[model samples]
Target: MRSQDENGRANHEAGMAGGEEMEMVEVSSEMRRRHQRPRKEEAEETEEAMSVEQVFEGKRVPGWREQLTFRAFAVSFVLAVMFSIIVMKLNLTTGIIPSLNVSAGLLGYFFVKMWTSVLDKAGLLKQPFTRQENTVIQTCVVAAYGIAFSGGFGSYLFGMSETIARQTTELNDAQNVKNPKLGWMIGFLFVVSFLGLFALVPLRKIMIIDYKLIYPSGTATAHLINGFHTPQGAKLAKKQVKTLGKFFVFSFLWGFFQWFYTAGDNCGFVSFPTLGLKAYENRFYFDFSPTYVGVGMICPYIVNISVLLGGILSWGVMWPLINNQKGKWYPADLPSGSLHGLQGYRVFISIAMILGDGLYNFLKVLLRTISSFVSVVQKRGATSTLPVLDDGSPITTSPAVSFDEERRTELFLKDQIPKQVALGGYVVIAAISIITLPHIFSQLKWYYILVAYIIAPVLAFCNAYGSGLTDWSLASTYGKLAIFTIGAWAGADHGGVLVGLAACGVMMSIVSTASDLMQDFKTGYMTLASPRSMFVSQVIGTSMGCVIAPCVFWLFYKAFKDIGISGSEYPAPYAIVYRNMAILGVDGVSSLPKNCLTLCYIFFAAAILINLLRDLAPKKIAKFIPLPMAMAIPFYIGSYFAIDMCLGSLILFVWELINKAKADAFGPAVASGLICGDGIWTLPQSVLALAKVKPPICMKFLSRNMNDKVDTFITSLS
Candidate 1:
């Protein structure tokens, strides 16, 4: 069978011509036991081959195992649902439930992973499933997670009905306002969530296939699947499984310790610390939580840079400038002058910066997409006049070579980019954009919507093709651009918009991680197992997650609040904007945040200019100038990643150098071990948490032991 290229184009004319003459290599019985039947020609080529037919003919189908079954899904689901109910009760008592606030979508992902693993072990589903199956599984998982984590339809309705009541209570004592009813809120959330999913589906083909977005998690999953295909792969997989089991145990305990020991106070194990620093008072603070760590690990260098830049602009540049102007030398009680206070200025600055960046980026992407579209159209037109060639027949009246004819003859031929697919994609984008317009307008006024819709596309185009940042999910740079426009129109108090944009960015990162995980597994399946079976596994996993996620969110929210933190404890930058709008008339927006805005704009502009000039400069000079990401990231966080990346690169370089010097081959095993070790180490925490056991202290103590083992192993091999 021929493999398709990224764009589905077939390039192997030789493979096509020599298809029947190819010999099949003998595959182990283990391999045969896992896969379906081979084609007739393949079976004939290897007489001793355990055909796909023999493997399934008399074998009993698998089902969920008793011990390691879909219990995770059920447990997650029940917990999530129960938590939502608990959130309602907690909301009544505490006013806000901090831990209850989490992404329902993420909860779904975990549920799906566990559920799919169960289904895979059981013979209910075929191995290597199709894309459709994957979709189904994902949907189910989301649903499951949602059921567990969501605050329920009734809760949203209650929130809506009590909005007036809550407002009234706020007027008397703002802190005493209870949580809003869940009915309408939940309804709206579900609606938007569904829309987001719908919007993503059409974009998948372009993003995943055409754009080839590398979902790191997906890649890991693919590696895992590949490992299941052969003896070597299975051995590696077994090791990973063991390592992950231990890691989860460790992580759970670590989480508990951080919650109990470090954070111990009137507020339970988790507390959002306030530094009392004027610039950060309104900002939510925490002592480096696991969620943050996980986020840091998952988010790429580029995004981290953007966030760091935003923070610096707000705290470093803007705050200092404001303090100097006031001649107060950073007063203890920094008067709340504007929306984000000093952070407001940063917001303004970010807007201006993103605008400039967006403009440059938009034109570039537009030009590329148009160019590609035109080229494809022309190719189709030209192909209409081409002569057909088949079965080695003589080409008659053919004026030019036919790429299509050549492509079709090969078994492992690349698929052509069909006109229909492209057209369909474009149509879907248009439809989604239109459908989402009202929601956008409702949330952001019409003027803001106009600016976002008009300017965002331009920025997206510029950034995507021009700067080589092809992942154009409106929530990234364009959202920053939108924030700028909103600030410009409504003033700096709307720094909350930037906060919202950041939240969206975080959500997108989560989604991207999940999607990437699926994609990686798909790649593995393509390489080793049946594609169909893998698809099924993915579907099963994703479905379970979907259903269970909501409940988890609810549980966490309640748990956090019961301990003392407010539900709104999560740094809701957007809430700041809402407060500003409510207090200061929309017309007095200028009196909002200013210092944060200025700093943001300054840094953003500087970063964009630096990157643009570097890109336009000669190759040698450009090489010396690192990507904008280096400048955009905050010095504190960026430095850590930089050092890590540098060290990793150095290790790889040294290994390659030594291997070449000694005339020895270095294999993928070393790299795989590093990657697997990192992922596996994190797994134990989850397992221990689920098991409701106190986290194991030995896991932490054994860190030195593990490192020593690794060092010894590496040195011995050397």
Candidate 2:
């Protein structure tokens, strides 16, 4: 207490000393951030960081705050609608799904802060948005996003409906009918998605609480929210807000110039020559989107290096070999979308690595989960006779609260979601899943539903484990395995196979949705936001998504005349992958082209080998190893996109070399703004596209036509 007082006094004296200078120089957020320093974290804390004992014993923060509020809900709902629609549209056109949590945090904090200022002027506003409220808003954003993309919403938008139509003989024959079981699909999604929510609660305790696993993205998001919620945090956030605002505006404008002014030809990347070789043919390029660069900056340098390595390995080395050995190892005529270039080959390798890494990570978590169970069981065996009527208080209460600061600091951990309410919601979800899973897919027998019910908990366990431990839920692969199993038993041989495959998508959605929920719950736990509020927000988003997804899909479907065509706006890589999974479920991988299968095996092995190599490599080398996802992602997307992504990463990769400390501290702020700016700008352009208004067209036309002379001169010189 004395130290805190001394520190505050010192800061106040410092402020007074600078008061005259403050008049001459504007006191910006950066100035405040540079000046303010907490005497001691706890003494200066608004919401104290969790104690080490709390981490080990699974104790909560010691205080309560009302989290569910009108402001939080209202913000969540609006962003949910906007992000879902824009996300679906972007997913279709670009095949890249941007996370809206950071964007949500940014926009929510700004708006609420602005609104509070307005209200304050009117003498009505009492306070700024609380950390809990901001968390609630983020909860909504994540929920809405997961629902739109993971909950069969985005899948349906891209090509699931038509894929179902093509695969189902009965649906195909129906006049002007697509996805004949659309209603069933809607119900199936609702049930599976929500049921997984309730069903995963048990696992949440094991994974998030007891084991205390950190969902990587979720943990980072929690910290971001934390920064905005508290006074000390807010000061830090001020510095970021400045950078974020400037860069966000800059990025949005730059995106507009590239996407509209250049007719999408110059979107985010610049083609660069590698050794001046046409054989490379602009295969190499640098993308300058701040978001990508930010992404590069945020991760450890080695991860960035690994990404570059993957690009070089696949495009530079692997492509040449594949080209030379085309007729022997690869097919004579590779499918346009499948291994179209070095870029095409990247997809297979990435998928292999992602699945391989996910499964490997899952196993690691599984051991922990199992060990936890063993410990619990062993504890029961060692129980004493004196504790027959043991009190629960000892276990629930923290014993270390001796001082005033300790008590005050521990205040935020006291409240939690009510057990009865959460469990009841889960029960409702379970009942819905049992009834709807079979009803949605009519071909499935009672036993199949029973099997799915039996398997759901297990799948949820693995999914939750992977998500909690590694932040990579390999639910898609696991879902595929389950789908293949269930589809076979449900009789994939029958004409009702498409229905069965679709059920798998729903099943996967359940695992995914549940996995996502647990991850978010972990975030809530860290931020001292009520898990109940997060759950409620999630349910709301999921329910809203059920209606919103199809509507958004229908909107884009109408707006874009040629959605899935070669030059169409929406590439929908996921939808394409999902379609292939359905086909593989029905026809089996054996029926696919021999060369494609061969490549799958080779890549799968490569993926596994690379991961093992990275892990086994000495720490110095291992730290630089790129994640499988980094290597794998480039292969599936356009070379231009990959190049841009790499470019963003390269900036950080280089920035770190220049100044590691400054790069580490301010890099995230810049990177996040850049990412959000580019992503958020897409909505306006998309709306214009939907309205059929060609923005910047006249400017582009005049410039291109007027520049023909310059172009001719340049061409003649070349």
Candidate 3:
């Protein structure tokens, strides 16, 4: 008789390609039980989770004692500005960023706590800072951090405004669509992001209450704030909020000194020693970016290792191969600004890998969403009231709806945003998109705007679903897919529309902000924060981000002076990818070298296969499949970041090794400070440059002809 696997495959609609191998791997119950993975057992363990109140409820002060306060409002604004500036600078330069909520919370908690202590000593203070104030303040900081980077909003665009302007000018001379001005991009994104606020109310029930998503990152933040502010933990050392503040301040100042005193166009140091093998010079060296260390500190070992492996494959192995056949695979004299010709081909492959990984995960989440919703409907045997599009058509409605009287209370409308307001906001944003998009990036096909608006809500929902469940925003992935999907609609006439690409930015902001909001709400729920207050605070943070992000971008421009030029101090890599992807949307992949295109397809397929196999594999085995973003980012940039990140992570790793118990208690505070320390100093350096003040040390870009288009555009606008 055939084995069970053989019998199963034989009875299926399509026979398994390797039934014998499948059957061979199938083990008997005794063998399987003995060899079952630790991870599998862990997953199967039906352990109780910590309740929200336990995780977030203040052990010292207890819970829900305070509403929003003036102090919370003021502290939130200050922290938002600080996070926005640092995040903008890091995203523009190193192209790697870490979240700052915990760090900001520690700092906020410290300031108020320290001051309160002084007041108590002086006998003038009525009350000290509370857990409620500190939590709300940090929540705002995290929201601002979310919106200031590549996947969040147009901050990435403004960060690369010079490059966009230059790309537009180059295209203008070539008779392509002239890209919109930096201000236009900012204004559009600001409005789009603000309108996303309306999403917060409706999404609460689905994302927060009913689904009860894990939101791992937010949960961690909740714990961090709670740990520091927990009135009295059983342990003595666990209660020091002041110590975390010291770490944040010390790191922030250290970063300022470390980078500000450097020479060259970039503060980072890259060593490219040829060692007599001239062809391999660029492949061997360290490119140190401090934030990489901070980021790695927070990331898992799997991600760190994956990034390192990817970098080795792309820069160390494949780069040499491509270089060896330069005349055929690429120009013997590669494009000057393209990281020693490695980027000329490696970028395409990296993007393909990144896109493949992102889309696959998205598809999984999408299925999860469908399944969850279906399960809910089936269990309830009920109908749901859906909203309408601005055009008066119902977005989703089932006639076989109408629940029992008791079930009617389960409607999503309870304690959510007013339906009419959400509908109105959608209509206004849609009108704004359709009317303004064409005028900004004139070359886009007309319907592309409509496509953006139509899909924005859907994208927001799905992206939020992923974020709520796993705290992975997937906005960058969805943005790339959007560019392709909308641009594909251009068809044979033109490969892609510039408008479609711009819309990609807008939709990215829309969805990312919505996801970020959901995370913020999770924190709010745990802390017993007012939903309406968070909305107001988040909107304020978004507004400040729009106002302050440009200044920081300009500051970086002043310090670097030649960012857009090839081989400049700041490569602004994310911008380069954005520029290229937008072009690809308009022009097909045919413009790339045949070898590069082949490599992209191959990597894309491999990424897809790996992701699919992970889904099929046991939980233990699947967990090791280095996350796609983790692997692909290093390939896209270089190994320098991965190496540095690992170094940062080693700090945590070693801490855990020596003292596992306290590592979780104080590790986040240290990590947060490490991330923010080197970043916040760039702002002051920016101010010094604006005053025509010569710095104690000045580093500038070393490109052959770095364009100052950003300065020129700023002047023109002024």
Models 1 onward score TM values of: 0.48, 0.73, 0.77
lDDT of 3 by residue, 119-185 (tens): 8999998655765566667766655554555332222353224454353222222223433244764
Which tens-of-lDDT digit does each residue in 16-60 have in candidate 1? 000000000000111111122344654463343224223223433
User: What TM-score would you give candidate 2 relative to the actual structure?
Assistant: 0.73
Candidate RMSDs in order: 15.6, 11.3, 12.0
lDDT for every model?
Answer: 0.32, 0.52, 0.54
Clashing pairs in 3: 60-231, 251-677, 252-677, 264-699, 264-700, 265-700, 265-701, 496-585, 496-586
Off by over 4 Å in 3: 1-66, 115-130, 150-182, 233-261, 265-280, 287-289, 338-342, 381-416, 436-439, 443-447, 488-497, 564-566, 691-718
TM-score preference between candidates 1 and 2, better one: 2
- Highest TM-score: which candidate? 3
Best by lDDT: 3
